[model samples]
Target: MEGGGGGGQELSTDNVKGIVLALLSSGFIGASFIIKKKGLRRAAVASGIRAGVGGYSYLLEPLWWVGMITMIVGEVANFVAYAFAPAVLVTPLGALSIIVSAGTFYPE
Candidate 1:
């Protein structure tokens, strides 16, 4: 419905931007979890301590920090997206994160 006279459902640019941001958030946040885990694995191997065992070696890993930063950016993007679009449209998008994160986090 491209008609301008009355009721025509159209996606505003803000909604589109919000959708994009939400998708990016899912991707970044999803990948960050795996990346951080990968970093922790490397740190544990190199430093002789697993993060799960109270080891802080992951803190020294640049890759882990990168994952942290990516997570933060994803969260920020998710927050900002709310300002551009309704929660109804934004909230369900989080489900995408599970799909995006699940496969990668347990990579074979």
Candidate 2:
């Protein structure tokens, strides 16, 4: 398929790889947020202080740490994906992932 505005240049394999990476990154990042939120809730219950109210107790929660690590991995994937594809193609896929994650986690 000839890419628009690229003088009939075909999409490279790297571009496909980038799109896949972007999708993976989005999924992980979304899961991380949900995990972190769950951890924060647990921390709040354990410590009697809500994280939203400036409680740092979630910092001690293992689940929260796991979520942070997940987010980091997602970010790294996103960065690498960016290297393989144009931002125009990558960004939207990432956004879609976020939407999917949100809908999966919060069903209200």
Residue range 1-108, candidate 2, lDDT tens digits: 544575766679999999999999998998998888889888999999998888999999999999999999999999999999999989888886568566775431
Backbone clashes in model 1, listed as residue pairs: none
Using TM-score as the measure, which candidate wins?
1
Candidate 1 structure lDDT: 0.86
Q: Assess candidate 2 and give its lDDT.
A: 0.88
- Summarize candidate 1's per-residue lDDT along 10-66 as a digit string, tens digits: 889999888888989888898888888888988998999898889999999998999
Model 2 residue 101 distance off true place after TM-score fit, in angstroms: 2.9
**Where does candidate 2 clash, by residue pair?**
none
